[model samples]
Target: MRIIEPVEITPALAVMEAFLVQPSAEPLVVQVGQAFQVASLLTNVPEADHPVWLSTKSYAVGDVVMLEHRNYEALVANTNKNPAGVGADPPNWLDLGPTNRWRMFDDKIGTQTTNPESIELTIAPGRAVDSLAFFGLDAASIYVRVVDPYQGIVYESSVSPVSTDGINDWYDYFFTPVEVNEDFVLLGVPAGSYGSIEINIAKPGGTARVGALILGKAAVLGEALYGTSVGITDYSRKDRDDFGNVVIVERGYSKRAEFDVIVQTSQVSQVQRLLSKYRAKPLVWIGEASYQSTILYGYYKEFNLVISGPTASDCSISVEGLI
Candidate 1:
């Protein structure tokens, strides 16, 4: 949430000399909003009182650097006033200022439970991915776990801790990707553990500004030919050989200026029904050209049909006759 402005480097001898004067022997910690300079281009000036001209290099806008401060106890006391007293049930302390502070509790805290609604994912299959990436903002740490259908954990990542400073809105967290040889897989983690992905203005530190945790599946496109089409008049399976040969033929014509011609199985309706049950969208294509002449197509191959569309539509697709 801290907006840091960048500093321009200029060759000013007087300005450079003033910066070389160290504050104290104790190192000062450059925290979230603090600023400091690094030593660069040191030169010897024999005539000058301070013979060394230490070029000061400012910290980058979003750089998170640790300062070596010896007086940490004193600094913490000054910065974080009203330090909580020691003991399981310590006495209430009075706040002296409006500065934000945190207390270390002795009691063990319970891990928060996350609902399914708090999880988001991008599905990618067939890609060479060693890990998964999660993005969020203002989080102490992130925890990841893969669960099976029986509510059993398959894999889990160590609580990856990240500093909250310099992380403005959202950042990416990567985890090892899981391999799936089956039909389906479930991957999830608590939203808080992954940094809140919700968007809100009022809750600045409330992990609500984090956007959707994009669950991407690293996948590669296979040899499978997937597409949608329309405008078919007749489609049926033909005769069978000694072993029963199932031949399919489709015939249709488009009179519109723009029409699409698709060769699919007659079970397109069934495919659409299954997709609807899962609240998915069925793939459909629009006609692109006008065909006054009738076209006929045949397929002697075997394939499957997968209809993907909106849950409200009644349509299906046949994988056969498509290849």
Candidate 2:
């Protein structure tokens, strides 16, 4: 579900009174002088239809009250008739409701296989997978068997045996890095051949009923190979008495190419002094040969720099700015 931010509305005191009378489909609705019980799976009790209300002075006859679902507390209602707590039940707890179940299907053809078929899983390599379990609903005991093309019999389990007590929920087949020797390899299957997971019934009277065959992968290792490192340099060209040196600004690791750098200076004069030195006649060299004699000038006050080139590995920059 998508989350949306609420729009801000401004209304005058007289207009607010008229706006308060409108009914809303929000979770809470308010009515003046009338008491209502908050409706929820737990608080509404056995019937699940009780309405909960809060008293408000400005509330009109049909005005709606919106209560944030997270803020309200569930408690037994107090009344003048039952003030002594004589027949009052314990406060009902709030219920958050059920989560949606995952859905799966075969490729248009309703065919379930048991023989060794190559299954191509788009999974992170070397990660442990736990949700890759197989089951079938039949009046017989069944087991799920899997064979990896590169690594044979990566997973086989008879623990989730079928029973008469309806189709069992998808059981998790836990596999650590040790179970699957190699990293998960995605292989292409031939036109007729495909990766197979089998559901074999052990005995009669038990039927093989299959739900969606589900598989999920999670990273086990804290770090992966897909990451990058950056090196930065800051040259201090302030005085002729001092030697120019580069200062490392930031050091971080990312799995992508982009990065950021921040330069902090005591005064703007330091930057100007550095730029003036670079603008002087300088000898540009590529490899061991002097390519050109030119002056490099620093343009902008703030440098929003991006470095990209094919031969970046062999490139280096040296400036004779004031130290």
Candidate 3:
């Protein structure tokens, strides 16, 4: 998503990744320049990012992925033994609701091989990926090789004989962190002269079903969309003059709105850092400002000046809306 900043500053693009976690847990979305405070993102370990759309991998219910330039959540997860060719939409994936971002393909092609399958993923041209996450079932082994654009094989390792038995038995395999400034990354059972692009997302030949393949660390704040202690910090209405006396025009809110928010948490830094990364993006606020709406979207605020004392609970945040 793109974020608009103040007239004095230029706009910035917010890079975000989507993922599926336990049904009970929330998925975290990363903002541009946010500190690596989350353990998953901070730890030099490979972890799941979001569910990967493995053309040949299988998925179950409640999984997530980005397909065809859209976010989708799986509902009734079922894989088609025979899937369509590349660039074709499979079957059975759905959006979260009448208005949602989750999606799934109706038909998923099964991996033809029972051995290691290779998947090659490419990072953005100038971007670097630090970690890799693997989620799946019934994989006997997972071998990872990270190659640089110029230098080959910067990092390599393999976990033989993964623990999970099958799709019914969900499990995950995380890799250690590595430097991936190169544009390409190769992952899967040992590529071993597969005659494929080594740096891109590579999957070894295998029948093992891959549920999710996140590239970065886990999002600790989850969505970072909700907050507490909200109140109308400022308000104004429109008025016009008609004839001799002034008359009130329709009471319209200003594009520039303000709100006082207090975030209560054991970790004040978490809330503070979240607000900082949230700068210059469209944010949703739910409270009196919403005015009969569950959420008031299209607000942008710069980094909040957090007031923290001895305890993690005492934290203050002021949100500045768009004008």
Clashes of each: 32, 30, 40
TM-score, cand. 2 vs. native: 0.18
Off by over 4 Å in 1: 1-131, 161-209, 220-323
The Cα error of candidate 1 at residue 130, in Å, is 8.8
Misplaced by over 4 Å in model 3 are 1-126, 164-206, 217-270, 275-323
Model 2, global lDDT: 0.24
**Residues 1-323, model 2: lDDT tens digits:** 00011111111101111122123535334454322221100110011222333442233323222222111223433322221224434622233221111111221112232212221112111122233322121223334455433344555655423221222344332222112100011112111111233334333432233322323231111111112122223343334334656544443221111112212223223433543443433211111111111111111122222234332211113322110
Q: Per-residue lDDT for 95-123 in model 3, tens only?
A: 42211111001111111111234433322
- Can you give the lDDT of residue 157 in candidate 2? 54
Instruction: Please name the candidate that would achieve the greatest lDDT relative to the true structure.
Output: 3
For all candidates in order, the CA lDDT equals 0.23, 0.24, 0.33
Sliding window of 10 residues with minimal summed lDDT for model 2: 1-10
Superior by TM-score: candidate 1 or candidate 2: 2
Ranking by lDDT: 3, 2, 1
